[model samples]
Target: MDDKSATFVVEGEGCEEDVLKWYYHGRSGRPNKNSGELSSKVKKYLSIKGWVFRYALKNGKKELQYQSPHGEVYNSLRMACKSYIDQGLGEGRMGNVDPKQPKKRKCLSIENQPLLKSVQSESPERRNKLKKQENRVVKTSKRVREGPVSSRNPRTVLSLLIDNNVVPMLGNVYYRNKTGPPLMKGRITRDGIQCHCCSKVFTLTAFEDHAGSTNHRPAANIILDDGTGRSLSDCQRQVSDSMKSTTTTLRTRSVVEIPKTVKAANSIRDENDGVCSACCGGGDLICCDYCPSSFHMKCIGLKEVPDGDWFCPYCCCGICGIGYVRDRSFRSCHQCELKFHGDCLNSKKPSEMKTEKNTLLLCSQNCERIFYGLQKLTGKPILVGNNLTWTLLTPDHRAHGGHGMKSSAKKENQCKLRAALEVMHECFEPSESVETGRDLIEDVIFGQVSKLKRLNFRGFYTVILEENGDLVSVATLRVYDNKVAEMPLVATRFKHRRRGMCRVLVDELEKNLVKLGVEKLVLPAVSTTLETWTNNFGFSCIPDDERSKLVQYSLLEFQGTITCQKLLK
Candidate 1:
């Protein structure tokens, strides 16, 4: 056989070496020895036809693999090259095939020579049309390889299907046999679907997936659309028009009789006299004695009608008379404006009254306690009777008769007095001067107690004895020649603070000083508590010049001290 006949026979058997030799010799008119050069040329031609050649290792041997864009891979390079040449020739891409090229006469006949020549000599317009046809074929092949193109948004598609009353299948519906029932019936949703035959609800994905098992069509899909010549667009337009008409009608309608409705309400209210002022006309109402207002007896917790008179809280005048009145006869609190009936006061409750002689009435226990507490904190008189007294003792006086005591009782009293005095000194004295003044006061008290039968220094003192015979507080009232009295010491036991003990002591001392013709009271002031004396007790701070003017009146020469004084008046 000739070279062309040998090539044709080798090509039929699909040999890579013979195919490469045929392709190279057909194009260059010379047999190519380099397999690499021949393979490169073949690859270039295949690429132009949208075929790709990839090199890979298979079973320890280097192999050339070919794939189409549609992902069809050829197992052999010879087969891929033969397929590519056959496709190119069938599409007239190799129409210019040389007539001199040798081929098997049976395959390349004279009848096919004219057709090939005509294709090679085709016009530009015909070639352009052919190119367009090839492009369309490529695109169609791509579409076939991929699935259908879904251009619409999923949500929009789903809504459209729902509005059209069409239940689109979510996925493929499977079956055990052609007539068998499906295992899974439907999809789950917030609101499930209802069955028509049994009048029950059933949610589903596809009718075919569940119809055989349930044997019932979905209620929503019972009405079949037999194409009455109406499309989904027509139904959508109808729904939109109805919605527009509803919104327009709502916008055009006017509010009805708003003013007349309000007027009717007011007239009904006037007919009822706007209800009771206190009870809103909910229960039995009584008119106020001093005003047009009325209140319910049940609302105020009143049991019976007042025998004398009745006044509402608004009608009462001033703080003394103002408060809810349950009875005909009531008394106002001396400390506050609240008034309560005489029967409301309980003897068991704490009273503001300092002594049994005090007759002031208080409305409640809280107000009474607060009143007494304020009096105690401010050092005012807390008692009214003459139960407490002031006595003066001299260093030379003897402990005998009514005032005399046994040595043991006297020693105990001295110790108690010393303890009380030390507590007072610590509270009133500055940190630096506490020890200095403490020793002096101790020496005076101890020296007198040790040397004499009775405290005999000619100094005035006031001591408050509790009901239990314990000293609650004490003070030294020093009377001067200039009609001024100085309170050198005033101290209460720590446990007795805020109990009016100090207040009683101060009151008794002042009364005695007034009897002695003392016109003013002077006392050393602490920087921290100076405001208590000035604001609560009406004492005023004396300036340096004014302090000197009163120096001759003060018996105790206070050095470098801030002093406050109060007039006896």
Candidate 2:
């Protein structure tokens, strides 16, 4: 090997001084394989300090060889170089490594002298370009200032509960006052101030009682006005365009509203006006036999409907897409072709009619049939195969009653079940998996009907699945309250398959529902369990497609109705 000139370029000034001192003091002998040019003093100092060299050795071929010492020298060197550059000393006559070498003009090495630049003003072109770039950056970030929100809320009795201690309870105002001048029953917010009875500005820190007050139950209407503007027009346009066909169509309909005026004494409510077409009884509310659209009596603006009258304006006689008149002065619906007199329709109070003009009222069932028919046609079986366990983070000790606790458990279980299903599919063939099971239909049945009943709205006893001692499967029932109890979710562990545990769980749930005042038992069965639901459990299977539309539960009303003659005894 030929003797070569050894060079070193320090990163920062501090590192430079240390390196120079170490080099000069470490080397004492003529450089050799055993004892290199490192001075004895520096070598001894390093040895005493227990430090070693960490570097990457590169040969003529530039292949890297790893070597480690007490510290990572390369990493330290890079960090020191970054510090030097950050201090803006590179342009001054301070320590700086310039890899670009002049002359041989070859790719230079960092193991050489440092280079610096003199501080001269930038040229006009460069200065102008920098200014333009700065301006462009600033302009891109410009934002329009938003104005404050307008305040114009109405006042009602509920406001009193905010500042005063008033626990709002159902029928609180109705039963308490019973016959006061209809007290204003809303929240107020014209100025920042609000009324005690109606304003909703209850402070979070309020120590006053906020429950059990007559102010809480004042009847207040929640009017959701889609203000007449371009936005409403745009929404209407979107909905209209999204409809299945451009042609106007009448559909099966039911009256969903009950007049709130039943308590007013001497209000001789007409007998024919309140009767339900479906059952002939004077039901305060009525649900459609087809879809999920509800209507109040007043909402239809019905001045009168004669005896035996059935069918709302929306119901098609299945004829000219409108309701038809039944024999003996019965107003029949144009859609669905069901005939009845006006009283059978069970119309709402005239004040509740708020649907936008030009808007068509169709039941949820018809809507689904028209729009999602294809999706339903193509729907397949659920890919099931997984062990799922759900731990309720909500402590079950609180006793929300069995209904609430069981409901929460079921909901959480369903989520966990879904996750487990996805995981199982991921582990197997996901593409071939299908969801032809009860879970999906259960979601719809419980979701749509329960919510309707909860709003103090008019609904009927349909199907209910109640969990029993965590062991029920499937059972029979007649009528079920949509409002009571919660939905139960089915879970499957690896060892629990094929033994009909699901069936057992469902049976238990259904029986328990009956025990807990459930009037009906309902379940959506696939080809696998369709016969089982009907034959074994005594449940009537709602035809598959419409299962998604109408409430699906067999009515097991054993005490048959008898409109016996009031004979002249």
Candidate 3:
């Protein structure tokens, strides 16, 4: 790195506005990792500093207002953040504090350079081909050094937190009434948690109130999602536990994990499994970083141990196509079985991708399509029949709870889920469910359905029907590869059958199924209803020889049942 370096190359003497632009926009380094991700970064930084961004109507137009740690307000987000950054740097200067550096970068560094100097410098400092990194690092020390972040240093914590992923929901959002996390119910924005239960986004500086209001039960069964899956006593506890312990858990960058890995390496040995999953042999095998599965280098076609961390086929991040991550918690889509790291997520909103549509690409657009698409369909009602109505009930419905109408919303879902389960029980015996261990079908409806994998029950939705607001028909559906869908169970209450309620449910399902790229719908029809399915629904009986085409699916079948299929496309 020299004085003639390109990063600080100023072609022309930039005016005061340029200085301010660089001050707010320059680091493009710390907060605001990418062009559109600025709001996310700034939101997190301001949040940690007790500043909240709010909407205000000015001149009949909505504008964001930045409220300070105290009651003071700033109309400009950049200016307020700048003042705070300068204040942090000033405090660091007064105490002679040295912020922690995790690694030594070969690129040039910012040192002895203050923010004020960048703004105030008007000399002939201009150079050609100015190289400005988005997130440029400011050197507090003349030389790069690696050390632990000081717990007493607040600014050090700020930088560390800024570099890591600052997602709205720290943990997976859960609905107690729903079996799994809902796709559309609880939304996470960059700045606030869009709670599904209360249907409100609490983004004020007094975010403490959010935790407080949710702590107590609003209704007998309606428990508001506090954004956190677990219950803390109050909002203050939520803050201290979430952000205060920032020193230890989220302390350093990826470089800091090296020592921990090296220390663990000392005790590394062949896993207790003793045999390679790939070879069924043990000698000279490398273990997966994320799981007990081990493989011979040649078995997986790896030349040797070539990386910082080696994730097996199942443990890798889907986006970055890499193994190591700053944040250890890896997320996976139960549908696609691909893994993801929080840090690797582009976190691009739908609108952001619209403007940069040609440039930005995601790992799998279909997964996103299904995610957002299903999210949109969760509570939407589809009028499919002359006198009946159809609606898709995802875990999202359980999340919304009818906008805080006490336990009624939750109780209604429970009743519907129970009703659907009853309709299935009426048609399928315990034997029909493929050995329920002598337990009643309804008893195990809500239990973990993993064992029913052959049916692909993991990713599914309940499409139900109503005749004048009363539950009349139900079906459990799952789509795979968007090429095939299976409705394992469907039934209309004996009395509701004359009203074409089941027809409405199937019609609504097929409409959405076609939209999701599904071509065929498969289902198991019991002996008694085989004619009804084959003759009325235009479903052809699947011959035993051709049934193997659906082998990839775990289609639920009764002991005495005929497999049937209907082509949608």
Candidate 4:
């Protein structure tokens, strides 16, 4: 080629062979290839290394030309192939090449001169940005070279232990003192301080004074390095001895006598009057069921009269001393409804009981078993379903055994109840009235009736059906005083409805109500089902004017527009 059109070339004739060898080595274990395949492979390899190959005229001869994006051209494939391989090997792309034939060190070549000059011709703004980036890299490297600095102040107890090089045991007690080693070892206790060495209990001040006394000796030998030749344990002991002597001198000078005014104030506070026990005077007082003393509701923190008789803390026998007034934590005896602390049931602390307010806390376990036995005698299954069983549950059952079901079983039952209620209200009740009825079931039937006494409302009796231990249906019956009762929530699973399940539940409930001397049954029926209820159950809708007649029976507060009553002769 003429000098004017000649392109740079590597000083080798087997340039194509060298490129093929490198390509095959990189993609080893691939199928063998012919001349055409070698040409195609080399083109692909060069393209990946950011070099493009094209057939172009050089000095009137058509030859393959290779060019980089940075504007360097080569007519000889050998030089272009060498440049691509060098860049790949330097960037770690050519893996595990023969180390014996080490790669030549990269140097600024004549072909790279154009790229360097182009970079140097950049605008001042761009150059300044590049310089700023280089400075940031240097700052970052310096930061990495320097190690982290720690704070002098210890923020937590764990940090303090770490700083002192003290390995703490689970039950080890750490003490802070003004003198000596600053921290002395002791034992943790429920009531007060206990000395680790002597195993004696003492108040906080007494323990501090005793621990720093000259007679005090190390409870256990601890190896410590305090940067001194002296034994750390011996040095610590000497410091305590010096502090004890100094403390004795200070204590003698600070001693003072009790003032007469302070003594007189204490005496007046301790003196008791022979009137109402809590406030020394009575306005409206509630007499304790077990004690002669009476306490004003306000004095004892009682907002309202208890549903059952009240017992003074002194008279109440239990681990929880005289139960606080208005404290719902106090459980009641299932049989008597008399308040007692849960701990009193088994002489266990509140934490150990693991029983809820609804859990039956009987006077004794025997009473609990008897209550269950009574339920077995009186209660019966009312609704049956496919692979399902139903049983009646009363508040008395909950008071004795906590929900009359296991936690998992209770959750399953609640889910079934919620599902059944949702379906029944949607199907039977008006759209607007559905929410009201649901609220009644949620707030009254399921929520409060079983746990709290509202007005003359007695308690809730639930008939729940289970299929293979999963709840499927539930019907809630609310009993009221004056021989009256109301059925608020009666529902069966959608799959089990119209199968006489609800009918069986109501029939069994009616039989039980008769046994309990219930003379009348009040049912809140939807407008759509009023006629069916009236015809099938012999219920007659009470006129709006007659709603006042139900005030005494508490039926006047019913939310449904149609209040039906069935007289049970």
Which stretches of candidate 2 lie above 4 Å from their native place?
1-479, 482-495, 534-569
Each model's lDDT comes to 0.39, 0.26, 0.46, 0.44
Q: Best lDDT goes to which candidate?
A: 3
Candidate 2: what lDDT? Answer: 0.26
Q: Quick one: best TM-score, which candidate? A: 3
Q: How much lDDT does candidate 4 score? A: 0.44
TM-score of each: 0.27, 0.20, 0.37, 0.30
Q: Residue 234, candidate 1: how far off, in angstroms?
A: 99
TM-score of 1: 0.27
Better candidate by TM-score, 1 or 3: 3
Model 3 earns a TM-score of 0.37
Off by over 4 Å in 4: 1-388, 393-398, 401-438, 449-458, 465-473, 492-497, 543-549, 556-560
Give candidates' CA RMSD values in order: 54.4, 30.8, 30.5, 33.2
**Number of the candidate with higher lDDT, 2 or 4:** 4
Better candidate by TM-score, 1 or 4: 4
Descending-lDDT candidate ranking:
3, 4, 1, 2
Sort order, TM-score high to low? 3, 4, 1, 2
Error of 2 at 255 (Å): 33
Tens digits of per-residue lDDT for model 4, 219-276: 2222222333232233333433454577567645533443555445223123221123
Cα lDDT tens digits, model 3, 425-506, are 4444333221122223333343224322321234566777864344567787766545567786676554444666677678
- lDDT per residue, candidate 1, 433-472, as tens digits? 1111113343333322211101112333334333222345
